[model samples]
Target chain A: TQLLEQSPQFLSIQEGENLTVYCNSSSVFSSLQWYRQEPGEGPVLLVTVVTGGEVKKLKRLTFQFGDARKDSSLHITAAQTGDTGLYLCAGALLENAGNMLTFGGGTRLMVKP
Target chain B: DVKVTQSSRYLVKRTGEKVFLECVQDMDHENMFWYRQDPGLGLRLIYFSYDVKMKEKGDIPEGYSVSREKKERFSLILESASTNQTSMYLCASSFGGLHSPLHFGNGTRLTVT
Candidate 1:
């Protein structure tokens, strides 16, 4: 079974603080996706990294996929109060598991002013 | 833009009562999934339908059943509500393919008391 584990289940930081959330797994994946969800809203896809050792940037957010495709990380720089939300990482396996994602426990971020 | 809509934003039911959760998608997606989101469990797929009248059991399909009568709508049924089932339920849709992205609904918070 493939399992994706996220570290620091909860994070609280002041405005302008930098933080990083990690997602680790022992099994290799074909692709990884990052999502941000706010209160009472569904998760919005931030980015999808398919290749190992891939890094994708979305403004103040940076996402990295492990070289072995077994892990991933999300980094936020100069985070604002608006950045507070639940961050989730999902992994997609190759084969019949196509389009199916296995999600992580998620990191709940709280940025206070 | 793809839009997934859940019939209810919140639902409260008594234990032993049957519950039905409905979802609809504006996009003609071939794959529709029902997932239960718990704080530590993340998003566990209960069931998924790839085509009309075709459904597959996911990793955690126990105590849950689903029906897909049409391509645009999917319904999840809980034979008997339980306190343990109180959580955010999410509906997502995506093209039935190898690497297509998924679109999600805002989610319905179901409380079983």
Candidate 2:
């Protein structure tokens, strides 16, 4: 079974602070994805990084896939209350997992103003 | 806009009761998934379907089962609801194959009392 380990299960920071959440694994993946979920809602996809060392940015969030495809990071700049949510990382592997996503434990962020 | 709708936003069931959660996607997606979200456990996949009546077990499928009688709809059934089974249920749909991001429903919060 593929396991994606995410660090800092919980985080609390003031608005405007910058933070990074990480997803690491011993196995390489074909692609890695990041999602943010708010209360009472399912997760919304933020970014999909397929290539190693690739970086994608959305206004205040920057996502980077490690050079080895075994890790990823999400950096939030000038975070706001709207950025507070549960962030999850998933991986698509080559082991014929049928494109099923293996999810991480997730990092729950609380941005207080 | 791709919209996935779950039948109920919140539900309460008694232990040992048969529970069903429904999800429908307006888009003609080929892949559908069911996941459970807890406070610290994050999201755990329960089942997925690539086509009608073709269901695959996900990471955590022990006490839950799923049915996909149609492409647009997927249903999750709790044969015998347990207290520990109380959690937020999420449903998601993806138009394309692997590497494509998923569009998720609002989610169903099931509390078994």
Candidate 3:
């Protein structure tokens, strides 16, 4: 079975700090997606990277897909209180399967003022 | 914006009771999914449908069943609710494609006692 492992299960940082969350997997994926989920709400898609070594930016967040399509990363620049939420990474194995996604354990971020 | 709507935000049920969770997507998406999220377990897909009346079991679908009678609506059913079934249930929809991002609802927090 394919599994995605996420690093730094929990993070607490002060405002204006920079942080990076990593998602790694042994199985290659056709695409990877990042999402941010706030308390009492479902996850919201942040970015989707389909190419190896691809990078996508959304305001203060930067998402990078691994060269082998087996990993991905999310970097937050100058994180603020509004950035406090759960970050999740999901891998889509579209080569041999449908558009189903396998998700990683989320990283909870707490940005304090 | 794509909108996915779940019928309930919270639900409480007794063991052995039958439960139903409803979801509707306004984007005319061809794919609908049901997932359960728990602390430290992230999100596990329970069932998915690629089109109307087409359902497939996901990673964890042992105690769960799904129905997609229409293109815009999907339902998740728990044949016999148990304590272990207590978790946050999320419904999502996506336009069928290789790299399409999923649009999610606010989720239903179900508690089986």
Candidate 4:
């Protein structure tokens, strides 16, 4: 089974602080995706990285895919209360003749003002 | 904007009772997915459908089944609900592609007592 492990299961930081979440796996994936979910809502896609060593930025959030395609990271430059949520990483695997996403446990971030 | 709608936001059921979760997408997406989220397990795929009347088991599919009779609607069924099955169920849909972004519903929090 393909498993993606996320570090720092829970994080609490003051607003404007910087934080980074990591997702690691031994198995290589074709692509990696980042998602954010609120307490009572489902996850929403933040970004998708397909190429090895790819980097994408969305405002204050920066995402990077490892060169080996087995890991990824999300870095927040200056965290805000609005960034408080569960951040998830998913790796794309080929299964049953289709692309399937295997998600990590996730990092719960709480940014206090 | 893409919108994925889940029929219920919360559900309560007794053990051994049959349960069904419904999902619909207005974008005519060909791919629909069902996932369960737990405190430390992020999201685990239960089932997915790539087209009408076609279903595929995901990594964690035991005790769960799915139906996709129409292009926009998918249903997840639990023949005998158990306490362990209680979770936040999320429904997602996306256009067919290698790296298409998934649009998700608010999610259904099911509690089987």
- Sort the predicted structures by TM-score, highest score first: 3, 1, 4, 2
Best by lDDT: 3
Give the poorly placed runs of model 3, Cα more than 4 Å off.
none
Per-residue lDDT tens digits for candidate 4, residues A1-113, read 32999988999999999999999999888899999998888899999998999999999999999998989999998999999999999988634246678899999999999
Instruction: Please tell me which predicted candidate would have the highest DockQ against the true structure.
Output: 3
Off by over 4 Å in 4: A94-97
* lDDT, candidate 1, B6-75, per-residue tens: 9999999999999999999988999999999988777889999999999999998989999999999999
Candidate 2 regions off by >4 Å? none
Ranking 3 against 4 by lDDT, winner: 3
DockQ of 1: 0.78
Clashes of each: 0, 0, 0, 0
Can you list each candidate's DockQ? 0.78, 0.77, 0.87, 0.83
Model 4, residue A44: distance off in Å is 0.6
Q: TM-score per candidate, in order?
A: 0.97, 0.95, 0.97, 0.96
Candidate 2: chain B TM-score equals 0.97
Write down the TM-score for model 4: 0.96
lDDT of 4 by residue, B24-72 (tens): 9999898999999988888899999999999988878999999898899
Lowest summed lDDT across 10 adjacent residues in model 2 chain B is found at B36-45
Q: Between which residue pairs do clashes occur in model 4? A: none
Q: How much lDDT does each candidate structure score?
A: 0.92, 0.91, 0.94, 0.92
The 10-residue segment with the lowest total lDDT in model 2 chain A: A93-102
